[model samples]
Target: MSSLTVAYAVAFYVAAAVLVLGLVVKIKQYATTPSPLKIPTMPAPRTRLGVVLRILREVIYFESLFKSNKWIWICAVLFHAGLWLVLARHLRYFIEPVWFWVVLVQPFGIYAGFAMIAGLVALWARRIVVNRVRYISGPSDHLMLALLVGIGFSGMMLRFVERTDIIAVKAFFLGLLRFDLQPLPAEMPLLVHLGLVITLMIVFPFSKLLHVPGVFFSPSRAQVDDAREKRHLAPWAAKLDAERDSAAAE
Candidate 1:
C-alpha cells in the first residue's frame, strides 16, 4: 500500500476511536448527572409510556421544531432523511456480501445526496440571513454546516464528475476491517470527502451534534409529569433526607 493509503487507514482508525470513546464518556456523564427536580416541560407526559412516545415524536419528527418553525423543520427533515439513506447505501462498502436492502438503496442514495446538500445550504443561509438566528449563531455552527456541505458536494462529485475506482474503494474499507491495509484510490474528490467525514467524526462528540444523543437525556423531555401524584427527589436529595431522619432519631 502507498504511504497515503496507510496514513488514511491510520487516520480512520484514530478518528473512529475518538468518536466512539468520546460518545461513551459523554453519555456516562449524562447518565450519572442528577436531575434535582420534577421539572418536566408543561403539558408534558403524565406516564412513562407517554414520555417514551413523546421522545420518539420529538426525535423522529422534530416535534418542537415543527411547532416553532416549519421552514427549519423542513430543512432538518430533508437533511436527516437523506443522510440516513446515504449511510444505509454505504453499507455496501463495508459488508462482504451486501444486504439486499442496501443494494436497493444505492440508486436512491445518489439522489438523496442532493437533498442532503440542499437542506444544508438552506440551513447555512438561515444562520446568515435571519437577524435573530445570525445574532445567536456562533462560528462553530457555520463551520459544522460547511463541513457537512463539503462532504455532500464532494461525494456527489465522485459520483458525477471525477469518477474513481469504487471497487478499490470498497476493497480499502474491507481490508481495514480485516486488519489488512489495501490500496486506496488517491483521487482528489475522494480525499476531500473522506477528510471532511473524518473531521466530523472526530469533532462530533464535543460539537452541537451531541444533541443527537443528548435529546434522549433531556429532563424536560424524559421526565414523566407525575409530581402532583408522587413526590420527586434526586438520588442525592433522597440520601440527604435519609441521613437527616437517622440523625433526628439518634
Candidate 2:
C-alpha cells in the first residue's frame, strides 16, 4: 500500500476511536442516577391553536439550528443539501446507469460540489470571525469541515476540469460494491480520489455525521413535547411510581 493510503487508514481509525469512545462516555454519564437540573422552562405559547402552531414551527423550521448564529444556520443547511445531493448522485455507481438519470446527475452534482465547498469556507470564516463559535469550536470540528470541503473540491476537479480516468474509477467503485478490493488504479490521481472517499466513509459513522441518526434519537425532537398536557407518562414510569407508592404505604 502507498504511504498516502496507510496515512488515511490510520487517521480513519483514530477518528473512529474518538467517536465511539466519546459517545460511550456521554451515554454512561447521562445514565448515572442524578437529579435533573431545575432550569426554568420557557413560557409555552398559550391557546390550543397557538400551541399547535408553535410545535409545528419547531419541527419544520429547525428552530435550534438558528439560535446560535445566522452563518451557522446557513452553513448547516447548505452543507446538508449538498451532501444529500452528492450521496444521491453516488447511486449511479451502485445501480445500472439509466440515461435520463445519468444526464440529470451531472448538473446537480456540480451544484452540490460548489455548495459543499462554499458552505465549508463560509463556516470556517464564521469560526474565525465569531467569538462564541470560535471559543466553542474544537479541532475536530474544524478538521471535519476541512475534510468534507476537500472531498467535494477534489471530486469536482476530477469531474470537470481535469477529468481523471472515469473507467478506472468506475471499476474501482464497482469492485468495492461487490465486497472486493480491486487492484488500485494505475493513476496516482485516481488513487487520491479513492483515498479521500474511503477516508470519509470510515470516518462517517464515528463523527458528528452520526448525528444524522442522532437527531431522530433525540428525546426533545422524537418524543412528544406536549406530553405534560396531552398525555400521561409512559406506562413504565407510571407503574414504577405506583410500586413506590405501594412500598411506602406498606
Candidate 3:
C-alpha cells in the first residue's frame, strides 16, 4: 500500500476516535455540573401582543445573528448552502446507476464547493480585519476553516482538474461502510481531498463550530416564544421578595 493509502486510513480513524471521545467527555462534564449560575430570566413582556411581536422578531428575523457582525451572517448562509449541496451530491456514492437528476445535481455540487471556499475565505478576512473577531479568533477556528476550505478546494480539483473515477471511489466507500478494505480509486488527488473531508467531520462536534447545532439548544432562543403572556419577571422578583418577608414574620 502507498503512503497515501496509509495517510487516508490514519486521518480517518484519528478523526473518528477523537470526535467520539470528545463528545463523551463533553456530555459527562455537562451532566456532572450543578447549575452554578442562575440566568436572570428576562422580564416577560407585559402584554400578549408584545410577546407575540418579540417572538416574531426573534424567530423570523434571526435577531441574534443580526445582532452579531453582518459578515458572520453572510458566512453562515454560504456555509450552510455549500454544506447542503455537498452532502446531497455525495448521496450519489451509494446509489447505483446515474439518475437523471444527478445531471442537474452536478453543477450544484461544483457551485457548493465554490460557496464553501468563498465563505471560509470571507470569514477569515473578517477575523483579520475586525479587532473583536481577531481577538477571539483562536487556533481551532483557523484550523477548522482551513480544513473545510481544503476539503472543498481539493474536491473541486479532483472533479475539474484531475477527473477522478467516481465509480471506483464509490465502491471503496461502500466497502468501507461494509467493513471491507477494498481497493480505492487510484486517484491520489481525490483521496487527498476526501481525507481532509473525513478529518473535518471528525473534529466538527468538538469544535466551537458546533454552534451550528448549539443555536437550537440556546436558552434565549428556546425560551423566547414560551415567555408569552406572563407577568414581567421584574415584578415577580419583587413579589418573591414580599413573600419571603411575610414568611419571615410568620
Candidate 4:
C-alpha cells in the first residue's frame, strides 16, 4: 500500500470519530438545554403535531428564509438540494451493491455539482459585496465558504480534468468499512479532494455548519404557542415548585 493510502485511511478513521462523537455531544447539549419560558415566534403552531409539521416545512423548504429574503433563499435551496443529490449519488462508493435510486441519480449528480458550486459562489459573494452582510462577516465564515468551494472544485476536476482510477477509489472507501486497506490512487487532484473532505468532516461538528442539527432543537421553532392555556416550566423549576408545595403542606 502506498503511504498516501495508509495516511488517508488513518485520517478517515479520525475524522469519522470526531464527526460522530462531536455531533453526539453537541446534540445532547442542545437537547438538554432548558427553555424556562414559552418564546415561540409569532404565528407559531399551537399543537405538537403542528409544530412538527412547521419544523418540517422550515427544514425542507427554508420557509422563513423564503419569507425574509428571496435571493438568499434561492441560493440556499440550490446548494442544499444539490448537496442532497450528490450525497445520494456518493452511496455507490460506500455500498457494495448500490441502491437503484443511487444508480438512477448518478447522471444528475454531475449537474448538481455545478449548481452546488454556483450556489456557494453566490452566497460567498453576498458576504463580500452586500454592505450589511459584509459588515458582520467574520474570517471563519469566509474560510468555511472557501473550503467548501475548494472541495467542490477539486471534485469536479477529478471527475472531468484529471481522471483517476475511480474503481480503485471506490474500493479504497469500501475497504475502510471492511477493515481491509485498499490501494488509494495518489493522483494530486484526488488527494486534494479527499483532504478537503476529511477537513470538512472533522470541523463540521464545531462549525456554524452545525446549524444543520441545531435547527431541530431551536427553542423558537420547537416550542408550542400555548402559553396562555398551559403553564411552561423547565424541569429544574418544576422540581423546585414541587418541593415548595410539599413544605407548605407539611
Candidate 5:
C-alpha cells in the first residue's frame, strides 16, 4: 500500500481501460465504414470462405509479407512467433492454476525473448539502413521500435542479469486482476519492463500497432473479388437508389 504501489496500480488500470476502449471504438468504426467496391487484391479469393482462409494465411504466415520481402518476412515471423510464446508463458503470472500448455512452454519462452529482441533489432536496422524505408520513417516509428526494444531488453535483463522476485511480481498482477493492489517489486529492470508494457498498452490503440486489428478490416483483404459477377453498392448508395426508385414510381 505504498504510494509507488498505488501509482503503478492506478496507471495499469487506466492503461488497460484506454487500451480496451480505444480498440473497441476503432474496431466499430472500421466495421461500419462501407466499401462500395469489390477491390480485393489481384489473385484474390472469389468466395467468402476462401477470403476467410486467405486472411488466416495472411495472419498466421504473413503470406503477403513473405511474397514481398523475404528478409523482412523472416524477421517479422520470428518476432511475432516469439512474442506469442512469451505472452503464453506469461499466463502463469495472471492465472491461479497455471495451464499445462503454459507450463510446457516456459523454457521456450526464455529463448523466445532473445529471438524477439533480435528480430526487433533487425527490423529497426532495416528502417535505418534502407533508403526507401528510412525516407518514409518518422519519429513515431523509431520511438515505437525503441519502446519495444527497451521492453524486451529490460525483460531479458530481469531474467538473466538481475533476477527479481517473480513471485512478488505475479502476486502484484494477480492482485490487480482481483481489485486488490499489491506492492510491486522495486527492482529497476522489472519496473522498467512493466512501465514500458503499460505505456505500450496505452498507446497501442492510437498507434500504428493498431495494424493488428486494422488488418482484419482492410477492404482490400476482406472484400471478395466479385465485381464482375455482381454490382457492389455501399449502404448509403443503396439507400439513394431506393429513394430514386420511389420518386420515379410516384
Candidate 6:
C-alpha cells in the first residue's frame, strides 16, 4: 500500500476508535450519575412504560421540540430524517449484496442530501439572525454547522458535479472492515467529505453533538413523574438514610 493509503487507513482506524471509546465512556458516566429528584418536564409520563413511549416519541418525532418551536422542529426533523436515510443508504458500501431496503431507498437518499443541506443552512442562519439564539451561540456552534454544511456540499458535488470511483470507495471501506486495506479514491471532493466526516466523529462525544446520546440520558425526558407515588432517592442518599437510621437505633 502507498503511504497515502496507509495514512488514510490509519486516520480512519484512529477516528473510529476514538469515536466509539469516547461515546462509551461518556455514556457510562451518564448512566452512573445520580438524579436525586423527580424532575421530569411538565405533562410528563407517570409510568415506566409511558416514559419509554414518551422517550420514543421524543427521539423519533422530536415531540418536545415540535411543541416548543415549529420552525426549529421542521428544520431539525428534515435534517435528521435526511441524515437517517443517507446513512442507511451508505450501508451498501460496507456490505456485499446490499440489502433490499437499502436499494429501495437509494434514490431518495440522493435527494435527501439536498434537504439535509437546506435544513443545515437554515439552522445556521437562525443562529445568526435570531438575537436570543445568537447570544447563546459560541464559536463551536458555528464551526459545527459549517462542518456539516461543508460535508453535505462536498458530498453533493461528488454526486452531481464530479463523480468519483464509488466502487473503489466501497472497496476501501469494506477492506477496512476486513482488515485488508484498499486504495481510496484521490478525488478532492471525496477527500474533503471524508476529512469533515472524520472530524465530526472525533468531536462528537465531547461537543454539543452529544445531544444524540444526551437526549436519552436527560432527566427531563427519561425520568417518570412518580415523586407523588414513591420516594425518589439517589443511591448515595439512600445509603445516608440507612446510616442515619442505624445511628439512631444505636
Per-model lDDT:
0.93, 0.64, 0.69, 0.94, 0.92, 0.92
Candidate 3, residue 240: CA error in Å? 14
lDDT of 4 by residue, 35-75 (tens): 98998898899899999999999999999999999999999
Worst 10 residues of 1 by lDDT: 227-236
Candidate 5 residue-wise lDDT at 26: 96
Off by over 4 Å in 2: 1-63, 66-68, 179-183, 226-243
lDDT of 5 by residue, 1-250 (tens): 8888898999999999999999999999999989876778888899999999989999999999999999999999889998998898889999988999999999999999989989999999999999999999999999999999999999889888999999999999999999988899887888899999999999999999999999899888988888878898898789889999999999
Clashing pairs for predicted structure model 3, backbone only: none
List model 6 lDDT by residue over 113-221, tens digit each. Answer: 9999999999999999999999999999999999999989998999999999999999999999999999998878998999999999899888998898899999988
Query: What are the TM-scores, per candidate, against the unseen true structure?
Result: 0.95, 0.69, 0.70, 0.95, 0.95, 0.96
lDDT of 3 by residue, 91-114 (tens): 778666767787578778878878
In model 5, how large is the Cα lDDT of residue 239? 88
True lDDT of residue 24, candidate 3: 68
189-221: candidate 1 lDDT, tens digit per residue: 999988999999999999999999899999999
lDDT of 5 at 208: 98
Which prediction has more favorable lDDT, 3 or 6? 6
Output the better candidate (1/2) by lDDT.
1
Q: Best-fitting candidate, measured by lDDT?
A: 4
**Model 1 RMSD in angstroms:** 1.6
Q: Which pairs clash inside model 2?
A: none
Tell me model 3's lDDT, rounded to 2 decimals.
0.69
